[model samples]
Target: MGVVVSLEDSKNRQASVKPLVDLTKGDMERVNQLILSKAGSDVQMIPEVANHLISSGGKRLRPMLTLASAAMFGYAGDSHIKLATSVEFMHTATLLHDDVVDESDLRRGKSTARTIWGNQASVLVGDFLLGQAFRMMVDVGSLDALDVLSTAASVIAEGEVLQLSVAKNMETTEDDYLQVIRAKTAALFAAAAEVGPIIAGASRAERNALKSYGMNLGLAFQLVDDVLDYGGSAAELGKNVGDDFREGKITLPVILSYRRGTPDERQFWRTAIEGGENGDENLEKALALITRYNGLGDTIARAQHYGTIARDALAPMPASALKSALLEVIDFCIERLN
Candidate 1:
């Protein structure tokens, strides 16, 4: 169901993200400055909580996407900087809210903002970030760009609600899960990329191309993140491995394992996920079941499927370092499994 790259391809993938990072370096610096400025407020705790996660070493990939997508059309303006910062703020706001909703303790290998500031502070600060993001979008003065980003915000909230409805429910279908991720994860990515072309006044074909690339890339990124929850080290994930299992989150691995498992295996899952029997022993058993059913492998394969689509989405664009780097980002996302 997915294209498997050669070992040679995989080995080369390690450096894939570097070029994009290099390409966006200057713009990203401006975006970071804007982030820090906007994240601040007279309320000491607002900046305190926002900076806790912002200063935590995230890749800032979403903002970088905005920069790169703009650069692809040779855009030379300050609006991309504002838009990129807005994208980052939106992303950060979502993370703060997600940690609270998931009741998580750690993010990026540090205590979550919610853990330090309490859920109310975390939620309120998240709202503040969102308000700042929309203000920046308005400052950009582009109705189309504003429309795309605002719609993504609405879709992301819907996705969160959908995920909550399915949480710990083993009966969640693959289609249902895909819909959730598309809205929650991919919507922002699509908006980030689409706005670039909108600001640049690129053709409809180019706009659609970047949107497709971002959407598929986001899907691949999140799918790989799900796989890492079960297989990666806490150091690699920046949080404890098996947190999904502990939280009774019905990720793709659990859905696959549950549907394919034996009767006894199914009961084990029900007890562990539905009954909330998520002790250390149960987590190990869940891992065993996921591996036994090749859930992780299948999930990686699904990621590869989306990764290919993301790469192909860039094929029609003219050759440039930015385009090449974007293609390599797809490979990097998939190769993270290794």
Candidate 2:
């Protein structure tokens, strides 16, 4: 069984996200329109597969970061909408590719694009989305923003490749895992937050601050996700529990448990993980071992560490509703582990 959060903690998480959602509602409506407009193609399969995932109930958090970050600096222009749309496209594109790579059946509790449309269609449509995202970035006409997002795209690719290299390898280090998440996940987040301030014409200091905030928050978000794989319900995760373990993906909890465990436990990890012998019985064992070795708790601790850094990143900025919401987002990310 996965770790369950208390009702109070769950409510707190909802409260943190609700404000950000409310604040960005109007901008997100515009972004949703742009996403729909840009996702269209004459090719029937392209739109079919693209919309399958795009219209799925993702919170659109990355793009919301773009909108809210710009709103924080009092941006009144339409470019933030374009940039936010681009961010969503980029995120959606990555999900398509990730589903194919992970061979996942479900995403957000719906059939994965690759599962419905086949891997080739999913990959091709993902490429189309990336092209559209780049075009929108060009339309935004800010070289700095373009450079940041474009670099993030490249880094995300590199992160996926790195994850491939480390997959099913029990020898993978915590540093190696962090590098993968930083590139694969945090890079886009940093770009999303940074572009908002960039388009708003905020100071370099402010831009860097949001970037730091996003980066650390991304790290914390991913760490909690790792913990959730062992501790959260399917409803909460939108995928099966122990999905990471079943996939043999080396996450922080697995890394910590594998390292801290006894020699016999290490061998057990090798058998289940590297040996690809994961079954329900083995998954139960894996969860027990994780708990015995304090893997989940320690991973949450690490997330909290990053969450603190994320909070401090915003300290110099003046207080506002947006800033408070952003800070609460950090707390929500960590509190999911409860």
Measured against the true structure, the TM-scores of the candidates, in listed sequence, are: 0.96, 0.97
lDDT of each: 0.90, 0.90
lDDT by residue (1-338, candidate 1, tens digit) is 11122222436336458899999998999999999999989999999999999999998889999999999998888999999999999999999999999999999899999988899999999999999999999999999999999999999999999999999898899999999999999999989998998999999999999999999999998898888888787876789888988999999989999999999999999999999999889988888888889888889889989988998899999999999988888887766643
lDDT of 2 by residue, 63-146 (tens): 999999999998999999999999999999999999999999999989998888899999999999999999999998999999
Q: Residue 320's C-alpha lDDT in candidate 1?
A: 95
Clashing pairs for predicted structure model 2, backbone only: 2-231, 3-231, 5-338
Predicted structure 1: lDDT: 0.90
